[model samples]
Target: MSAPIPNRVHYHKRDRELELGYPDGESYRLPIELLRVYSPSAEVQGHHPSEAVLQTGKRNVGLLNITQTGRYALKLHFDDGHDTGLYTWEYLHDMATHQQAWWENYLTRLERAGASRDSGVIQIHQV
Candidate 1:
């Protein structure tokens, strides 16, 4: 199947959501945090499955800029000093479609590693 082309892209600063509008009267709101965590860069995805890096403390990350990379993708400039991820239309659509499952998986990994999204603040619980 061919990837859907985005007609327009709008970033809502207050909502931290990237609104992607398509020609087929469809739209998707992709959260900034999700984009950051799932960045399609070697720095994040790594060279191999075993080398994939788990991103943390990115719950409040923001998008700084978006540059068109030909007709295929957009280079995402993030506020957290990350500007290497080129977000393709296909990738963005997939992420939006499976956001729930992907987010749940990310949270599960964080829990297993005892990592907090809140600036890596380790919470102490009295047992």
Candidate 2:
């Protein structure tokens, strides 16, 4: 097998999906819902690991636009008005490669915490 080639990539926004393509012919279609829930913005990821917020009710989310951020990342605009995450090329690649595992882990977390991705009260106690 040949080694994977690193090439410039682009993100195309559609109604409900985002298409990512590279010059090396590697491409993937990522659902908007997944992208929204897993956004890398401070609002979603927070400043620290423990401060991360659980995103809810994003099953029907859609991408509104894609803005270039310098030469390293892209800012994704969502129909829900979420446009803070600066998705670096590395981050996007990782998300595409590990999507299934990431989603499964997310679901497991919700189940373990008795939290629903759509609606659930979260109580964070600082010690």
Candidate 3:
């Protein structure tokens, strides 16, 4: 089944989230921090899953802009200068639907790497 396309999109500056409204009356608020850390850009996701980079110090990152990419995706602009990710409709819907589980997994990964969400506070892991 195809994912639902959002009919409305709004970025909440104060809350630092992107709110997506669907035609079926379901809505989701996706955090800016979550979007940044899970960005689908090659720089973040890498060429392979095992090569994916761990994003840290992104709690203060801002969502600068959101633009359409030929109706299939959205180009997300970030204040941290990351603007390569293309968030497709299907990806967005899936992300919003499974955000809780994905977020917990992100936290687990961060903990395993001794990473911090706050800026400039990285813990060096001796390997």
Candidate 4:
């Protein structure tokens, strides 16, 4: 068996897409919006999977900066002052590959929860 080959990745700012070219001659395009909401930061993902809070009001959000977190991951800063997620290469690749399924699931979850992505409500309380 041959070794797995690394893919060539590219970011297109104008189109807001991240493209990945695989050695097997396959390519995929992932949107910036998808990447931002699916960020791996604790602020976005929380401490556990059950603690993940749905992100809303980010339809027009865009990437502000992308800083390398060593050679294994990237720290993406969104324009909305959200600079917490650390996206590893593997996680990013998985998100890109499963974007459709993940998005559908998210929409279904939102509908079931009677939540709107554009809702601008922040629920906070003090003990």
lDDT of 3 by residue, 1-127 (tens): 9899899999999899999999999999999999999999999999999989999999888888899999788899999999999999999999999999989989999998888989888587678
Which candidate would rank higher by lDDT, 1 or 3?
A: 3
What lDDT tens digits, residue by residue, belong to model 4 across residues 20-55? 676888778877777777778787788999988787
lDDT of 2 by residue, 1-115 (tens): 3323335434445457677777778877777778888899999999998988877767767776788888777888888899999988778778888889879977876666666
Worst 10 residues of 4 by lDDT: 1-10
TM-score of 1: 0.94
Ranking by lDDT: 3, 1, 2, 4
- The global C-alpha lDDT for each of the candidates, from Candidate 1 onward, is 0.90, 0.75, 0.93, 0.73
RMSD each, Å: 1.3, 5.7, 2.0, 5.6
Q: In lDDT terms, which candidate is top?
A: 3
Candidate 3 minimal-lDDT segment of 10 residues? 118-127
Clashing pairs in 1: none
In candidate 1 the C-alpha lDDT for residue 12 amounts to 93
lDDT of 1 by residue, 1-127 (tens): 9689898999998898899999989999999999999899999999888888999999899988988899999888999999998999899999888999989999998888878787858867667
Question: If scored against the real structure, what TM-score would every candidate get?
Answer: 0.94, 0.78, 0.94, 0.76
